[model samples]
Target: MKMRFLAHFVALILFPCWFVSVRAEEIKSPQPCDFKALFNFGDSNSDTGCMASAFYPEILPYGETFFHEPVGRASDGRLIIDFIAQHLGFPFLSAYIDSIGTSYRHGANFAAGSSTIMRQNRTVFQGGTPFTFEIQVAQFNQFKNRTAKFFNQEKENSFTKDIPRPEDYAKAIYTFDIGQNDIAAVISQSGMEYSHAVISEIVDNFTSQVQYLHELGARTFWIHNTGPIGCLPVAMPVHNAKNQSLVAGYLDLNGCVNYQNDMAREFNKKLKNTVVKLRSHYPDASLIYVDMFSAKYELISNANKEGFVDPSKICCGYHENGHHVYCSNRAIINGKEIVPGSCDDPSKYISWDGVHYTEAANYWIANRIVNGSFSDPPLSIAQSCHA
Candidate 1:
């Protein structure tokens, strides 16, 4: 396993150059940014293992595609965060909550599965994790302060390589990939009356959080807007067609609920505006807002062209008869025996389970956005630093 990881590490270091195209002018980075670390904040989309570590560990087939074992990720393999780490020539960011063997030299991830931007009126047992975006930020503050304290102590010298240097904080990449669950939760509970006020509040909370991170020394911001939730199989199952009458006329050709997509777009619009506002307020900060909706929607709408199969069909778990048995769980659904499973070809599928994307799909999205194709300033991830 060490040999395999070493090979990957060497490959990344050898091939670290990426071209940054600026308005028909292609500029090559002599080398990637001297980004010493990365501090991430988000939900399941970028979760390394926070939720699983704090809760139950994901079983086999969760990390089967890449790790050959469950490493507590909610996917079949690597996530966009993983690709981001690989691209930046850093080891994967360890979850802040997962203390076992976690080395945070490159930075720490505060994301957790099903985390929301604001506190919901439910428990972790209901759906999302208890750590809201605000809580994650608080955790980041604690991690930073505590690590600083440790560094000031003599006996903690052993953590020189496991913790970030004081100067590295300003050079770290702060990536955010949340808001999908918050919006989904709202729409699920409130139906078409999905409160824009709630969406506004979430966006405001997101902006505040980013500003806090910036104040904490994050200079380069890589923010991802919510994806097209309308296309998610988990959002609208075929068995629940009767319940989709509200979106019957709004359904796109590919069967995605356009109204839900519109809501996502609304959220993205507000988010983009907030980014613009932030950039204006903090000119020295590179706040890159990524259009994840277009990146994901394109893949889903044109899956065949991308060597992928059905866009809505999942690579893991079974959803039928208005019942869903998750990837690693088995149950008797509608008188049929359900077993834990996944598709034979995960690389050819868009979604992993009904909720999360497959590793292949994740890689595709990461590849596109990293090049600045979907970014606001059209700056590649390597050139995201304002410094």
Candidate 2:
């Protein structure tokens, strides 16, 4: 009792501003989670640079809106993972494959562009990451094992400057924002019928990775359900809808492909159930399920009302006939080399290049999600510790 009172007295003396809050439990602390680091696994939605480093590096107009140069992110600016890092009061995570400007002091990102829960294809040339969820899980294990060796030898290792502390592993937050590409791949390769039926298998693959993380000493997990791929302009062309050849259904109210959105909705439902099932399996862990579908759907469904152009509009890239020219990519137009380039103001748009969201749209979605409105446990990122 004396120690508790003395600690309060010292706090009152050191900080007199909000120290005298009306109630002890009412304080909205910055990070009640107090997560030491962030370890993320996902696709392009959360990928920082792994795919770019291993495959093709981006150029101008990719990160022009924020970084003023290519930094490997597909968006015009930061992604939701960047915003989540800010909410955690930590620096943005570095890709495990990107060696330059990297410091694992906070954590590392194993996400890659076009990643899927189930293994799809090899390399960006093949159109998706070979680094599937299980592969990323193996990479994470390797990282954790190797970094620990360097940290243990810090006394003799001058290169241990940016390595994460050994203790932070348990105190870190592990996030997953993948699984969209899996459905897309199946839909493109097979048909809508197989994609609809294979959702359970997809969830099963995702669950195995989470179980591995828990076994590897991961305590807190933040899982984001897949978003509305039906709304993406890049995804629209792939849909059999426009031609009414594959799935016979009209576009939804939001001008999105109905079948694609249905796939995302079904995936989210099963993913949520997977989280619930895992919570019982790992009684000592904190598994948080965040509903990214609703949050992203909200933005896409109301892009114009929130001071932005149509959600289906592309801020960067050009479509010449059937060939799509993404931002900073070269194309021969009329027998001339040309880059379609980006818009004059990316902030006014939602989709960055017909696929990913712009920094503005990302920020808007981040604001709504970090507040806990879409979280399964109904807790903000800051308050995820309890959940």
Candidate 3:
């Protein structure tokens, strides 16, 4: 009974077509400023080279577009965070595990391919192990420690007599992108059949994860609500399972699992409220919530405006059944094993591999974030991006 109630609630709340009007001007970009460094955290979507170098299935097609060879991104080229850093005048962050000294000084990326914003063993899907939000925060703590040591040594050598200044700390930027994996996990694993108590517990734990980041000097928060999960190649296959003999247009195509999507929306709503509640506790804190769902929807629904075709289909996949073998898989023949083909132009598609966005899509998202379209009224994206 509780499970059914939760499912009904999700269906009602997560449907994107039903939106309330919040009249406001489109947010604008802030006057550009320089930042010494950037740090990112999230799943494969935001991973630059962490997973590509760390994991298997290494192949040319991985980073073939931008690097003309694999550089460890889930996409064919750069990620949104990469663009954000470059836009701000800093070099792209090196992975935390990278051995290069100069890249390490620019900043470090803590993002892993399958990370989540929850502490539980909840996965992004059936067989994926995500570094929980708690784990990601831990990685940040490590980065902070390393940075302090590096800067501390620099100050000692340069100043030889004075204490470290606040300006030194201000030079670095810590950016984050997560929460989608959590919603995806709930949909794929629990499937809206869990008890309300279970759902509530999960939400509670998630809220705590955000609070943890706050305590750790995470001043600038770039939180993204889940995108249209239901519309993805994976979710589309699961949506409307009972509606057989139906045309493709007949499916409930709101982009995400209804209940889980609602969970994401409600999480965003409550998160905004939570941020308000937290301001008193952390006065200097700056938190910005990006409505990734709405942004992606506008891009996809009005593809012509963005000059894109189907945002639904990925650029690379198994020709058969569209079951979606790994994007970098070198061997995928006709229902067998052999080298496959990648699209000539990945930028034309929103999705690069089945599960991640193309460099083009990430660029568009970064533009919206800079433009302030995703920001709450009055505060603005520029204020938050630099906050």
User: TM-score winner among the candidates?
Assistant: 1
* Model 1 TM: 0.88
TM-score of each: 0.88, 0.86, 0.77
Best by lDDT: 1
- Provide the lowest-lDDT 10-residue window in model 3: 159-168
- Summing lDDT over every window of 10 consecutive residues in candidate 2, give the lowest-scoring window: 238-247
Lowest lDDT 10-mer window, candidate 1? 18-27
Query: How should the candidates be ordered by lDDT, best one leading?
Result: 1, 2, 3
Q: What is candidate 1's lDDT per residue for 98-133, written digit by digit as tens?
A: 989989998999999888997866432246678899
Tens-digit lDDT track for model 2 on 293-370? 899889887888999997777888886445677777888877977778788999999898888999999999999988
Better structure of 1 and 3 per TM-score = 1
Task: Judging by TM-score, tell me the better candidate of 1 and 2.
Answer: 1
Pairs clashing in candidate 1?
Answer: none
Cα lDDT computed for each candidate against the true fold: 0.85, 0.84, 0.63
What ranges in model 1 sit over 4 Å off? 1-31, 122-127, 153-156, 191-194, 237-248
